[model samples]
Target chain A: MANTQVDQNQVLPEYGPVTPADIRRAAWRHNLTLQWSWNYERMQALGFMWSILPILQRISRTKEELIANMQRHMNFYNTNPAVGSPIIFGAACALEEKGQGEVADSLKIALMGPFAGIGDTIQAILLRPIVAVLAASLAMEGSWAGPLIMFLFGLAWFALKFPQVTWGYKQGVNLVTTVAGGALDKVTEAATIMGLIVVGGFIPSIMARVTTPIKYVREVTVDGQLTEKVVELQPALDSILPYMIPIVIVGFAYWLLKARRQSPIKALLWLTVLAFACSYLGIL
Target chain B: MTYGIGIALLLGIIAYVAVVMNLGASCFWHEALIVGAVTGLIVGNVELGLMIGATLTLMSLGMWTYGGATIPDFMTGAILGTAFGALPGVGVEGGLAIAVPAALLMTQLDVLGRAITTLFIHGADKAVAEGNVRAVTWWHLLGQLPWGLTRFFPVFLAIWLGAEPVQNFINWMPEHIMKAMRVTGAVLPALGFALLLTMMPLKKYWPFALLGYILFAYLNVPMIGIALTAVAVGILYINLKEVRARG
Candidate 1:
């Protein structure tokens, strides 16, 4: 995250100061359409440009300067909207205010990838799955706590907007130095550990609940009297190891995804076919 | 007529909000759980909505749109699924049958939405060349149109066109086929969990995963219980590592 090209001790020339009001305005729009304009060509360029327009407007003296700066930002820009984008927005604001627009552009291009990794790990992998699964489990049980939990968790994201922006604004490029020190990695490590454990729990409790419907029955005459016998495969397998079939199925799917490199769509189609065939055969 | 139209309109609004106003952390509003719950509330069947939504959530576990990738639009699927399933004799599995494939198909619309927004990006590009800052912002704002429309139209038309045809389609489904669909629903979640496992650092953390599996399978510890224990272990792991670093 640390770039040697950026001299840490270089004193910035003071220009139009980016006000708190400008930051607040930018933060408000952060939630609005940050990814709505995501295109294959430039990704989040339009939305990212739109979000920090207020800050750029306030910091630039001449109309020409503002347009030029906006055009610079409109270049290929994409990152996780929550954690990554805000820091970049703040850093951009800080640099634009000092009229160091070229450095800002280069830094945005450089840092977007790493921040995206961090943000995706945090938001997509850990938080969304854990919270949504927790809430979904509750929802499955017919508790109103499902939506209530989701709504409450959403507020935490909303609350993060202000401080994240403020921190980015305050730290500017120094934020990269802090990230380079490996703190974000620690956070990612913890999250991965927690996510693995939680999702591991989900494998058996949720996915492995798909029980087999197979059963075998027999009748025999013993000592001149009729006797009946019953053998249930699901319970038999469960007694040996609970959720054996489900776990095997999940493991196979994992092999397909990782070993075979099958697309999720293809895997899904095949699974649907297999499920129907197995059901027709009374295997599940 | 009005009853159907009102619910359709509400769902359309929700669809628009879910996709456009991602709100930083994406707010998980686009997740099936929230969408399904909201749809359930609108269609006067929150419990059914949540149940179907949960199923879809599990089915969509590791399916995230990272770095401009488009996954299935189960959020919209949940809305239509819940609304149609809420009808008499439709049932949850019937909803699942329609919703699952519909969602997979909806990925194209998501791609289209992104492409449509590229037009707005070009609009912004033109505005930038002309030095009209306000116009650039306007182009950015107008980009929301395709995103909103892509989600809204499917939800609105599916509900507005009403559920008679859908219900008939479900009713006409053979008993064994319905049974197979139910089985498919049950087994498909394995793919989701597997996807999560693949995405995770399972090789490094297999021990914790085993701990979780054992706790759930043998001891019957609940999910929250396992989560709490994991949190404690995580903190302990981090602290121990820090101590080692200092030494």
Candidate 2:
């Protein structure tokens, strides 16, 4: 989507260094409050400003400068917390320091959707679940290390904080400019494929255990005399395909979600009601 | 169980507060095992707590609240469920059964918690007008209190009020209804996957979805095994795309 084709030899000009104190403070608060204070009008504006305050202080000479910078940043911003790299935000800080607020703002907005896409795919869809499964499995085996292991992974996110924020600052706008390159797209696209496959794989292992309660006592003539036989339904379906009922239920949910355009809440309420009613009647 | 009320209250608040303060990963703090571990420690039954926590963790496998959507409140469910599970005769399954409905019931509180944060947002607006940085900062952080309280109240009550009524209710539930509840519990997870499916930009990824289904349903592969397989599939797809693009 980038027309200018700003290549490697270009060596985009760098903004002056933000003080060490500013970087330290900003990086520390980066994860804080950003998850909450998510408002309707501007999702993470308050938290984003809170994160960059120290840098704004370093760059802006006057009260007017500070307020103006804060107001500009207070505009709408929402992103997946994990995959929306602090590097991107760091680059935006550099842009603002170089007095390119509008450019930085536009870049932030433009990058959020893709960041959310790739971020959700990797962090939400892939890594988090895998970690949970591994840790929980370990816990189930009577290991105290299970909870310890999970907490350690959580701590690993902090390890990402310093390196990324500093890298974004060092790379400045050059790194962000290359974000539109084909490489990131492939990463995102591949992640999408991986995510879909995982979701499909999980359908049976996780959700497809429902079985029917219906059974019939059938009468048949055997050796010229009446004979009674019991026929069952759930096992019949299971014989054809394991988790068949679950697949059908999940498929129905998909149809309801997409074709009916129902909200997740409404769909959940409906499913819960249907499950109870059907199970009550011995239909499933 | 010596430090009953105080410890239960603190841990419950910690679960929601940690998320707001960015002190913990949203994924980590919200997991049942973690919540149960803390609550279990409070009630002196860390072993039962861990198992109950692990059980709910599996139930919630692969579910995420992407785009900030509310799902069942697993944290509260774990805390309260494990507290009850700590009692005599209540095993891990019983704890999970308690958790299933508790998690469903707490979704409303999750919504209310988010709604209450708006007042702080408005307070931040006023802080901005006055150029009061302290006001802006504190107000934003203080919004977390209501969310913490939302969690704390229910958990404290469940533990403090005695587990008799809740246990009796579980016992009083008919065999048929319990069967139905379990059936519904199994189906509820599908809604989460479906929400994600709708959000995914499937484009050319549809075939891979079927491939996953066949691998799991026919082959009976475990989740970890399927994940490794997906990595291979993802790499192959990327490689082919590059080849076609070059040609």
Candidate 3:
């Protein structure tokens, strides 16, 4: 069925005996509830099994085979839902259709870790911050664009799940090399740099109000006459550094969270207490 | 308020269910910004909701639930906080007082929900053993109960029973305590930035961060301006690295 007129890249690999409709059903399930039944013991094992149950039911001739496949997918599994699950599921689907159940299991185990790393970095750590921060900045300003932007960004990612799964099925194991290459690394690195910059800017702007309200009154002799002068601590601190208070606060928090290895809850509580004391003492 | 108690209650449950199910994208509805806005819209104050959501968004930044480890349930916090903030005198500062601590406490509930859902997973396992596909599907879908209820109960309770008490508590506060709450709210975003810094490779990228700060603080550049500059710098750095590698 090789047509010379068709582009090689566009052609999907024959998925053995399974109909295209079956893959679509599996894709829809994966897209919808990849993390619905998330648990401590198996993470996304239940969701994973359920998403691919369509394929398992279709490919298995006997009830035992279906049960075995279901049980196998129920093993501990976790990854970035957007990118990782689709690829693993796609490859697993291909392998299952070909009656290589053992190979599919091993493939799922091996790919989950690396794919999680890449998927989390790209989707969660990188793009998420950028989009979320931007949307938040807008939201903070009381603009309708805030939620609209976030909703759109999320919808775009949701839409990607389908094509990504389809591509995974088409490429199968071959998709690994394409993703793990240097290009992904470069993209991730660039995103990291951008994220750092955005966060840095946010520190000064978001915490602009956390300034000292203390003022000092001093008497000075000017041409043999007594003159009174008023000086504010906030202006003085701003002269030294625009956001010195904010910088110190962020620095202290970073130290508490990183160097001290304290839980974020502790850090937040400490900050709240410190703020209360500072306000009470009139030092803030 | 735009929406009544009934509508707010319904929206809260839907928000929880949508997020837990990962219906659209993973953690899409879970982010504070979206949740805050939704809560705000329900309460007839989208603006206040967005503001609180923005603040909580920063607080929840970099606090992803990677590897099944539970983080604070700020999404729920955003809902309750926005609802509280939308009250007559509670405002954004008062919202923070409740939202910050409530988020931390909700971590325990998060653990409880996960634990309960583990029972459902075990049920799914049993269904699998019996070769009962329908049973397995039911068990898996049933896990949504714990996840959604953990959020629904608090949000619904807050809107139903907690509102009057919260308003009374705010009215009872002295001036200095209220000011302290405002100060606390102002300073809390720093904790969010700090947490994010811990997750980032700040040591290697300190200069860019410094540059961002200087551009915003000293030059009075806007966020979008700083962001554009960052992109330029990133491109420059990447190109330089590529050249060095080639050499």
Q: For residues B1-247, write the lDDT of model 3, one tens digit per residue.
A: 3336786677568557655745325547677888889888877889889998899988777877655556787888888888878888889999888888778767656766665675677688778988799999988777778888877776676677765664575458576865675666567656656755765678998887888788889999866577677778877888999999999
Better by lDDT, candidate 3 or 2 = 3
Going through the candidates in order, their DockQ values are 0.30, 0.30, 0.30
lDDT of 2 by residue, A1-284 (tens): 12234353432222135767767777667754564566322446677777877677666554445667676676545566656657667777776665556556545544554455567677767877887888888888867788778877867855675677777777765644555556655645665677667667766765555678788999999999999999998788888977888788777877898999975557767887888899888887
> TM per model?
0.61, 0.60, 0.60
**Predicted candidate 1 versus true structure: per-residue lDDT over B1-247, tens digit per residue:** 3246777788999988888756234666777888898889888899889988888988988776665566788888898888878888887998888788778757757766765565577678778767687788788777778888988987787788775554565458576765665566557657656755665567887887887788778988766577676677766778899999999
Computed on alpha carbons, the lDDT of every model, listed in order, comes to 0.72, 0.67, 0.74
Angstrom error of the Cα, residue A58, model 3: value is: 1.6
Q: Write the per-residue lDDT of candidate 1 for residues A1-284, one digit (tens) a residue.
A: 12235443332232247777777787777655677677644667777788888767765555556667677777666667787678877877776665556556645654565466578778778888898889889999998898779878987876786688778777774634455546645645665566556656666765554788888888888899989888788888988999898888888778888999996556766777788899899888
**RMSD to true structure for each model, in Å:** 12.9, 11.1, 14.3
Candidate 3 residue runs with Cα over 4 Å from true position: A1-16, A173-284, B1-8, B21-24, B163-247
Worst 10 residues of 2 chain A by lDDT: A7-16
Residue by residue across B1-247, what tens digits does model 2's lDDT show? 3236766567667665644534224536667888778778877788878888887887887677654555787777888778777777877788888888988867656655655564566577666656577887897667667677767766666666566654575567577766665566656656655655665665556887787788888898755566677778887989997899899
The per-residue C-alpha lDDT of model 2 at residue B159 equals 68
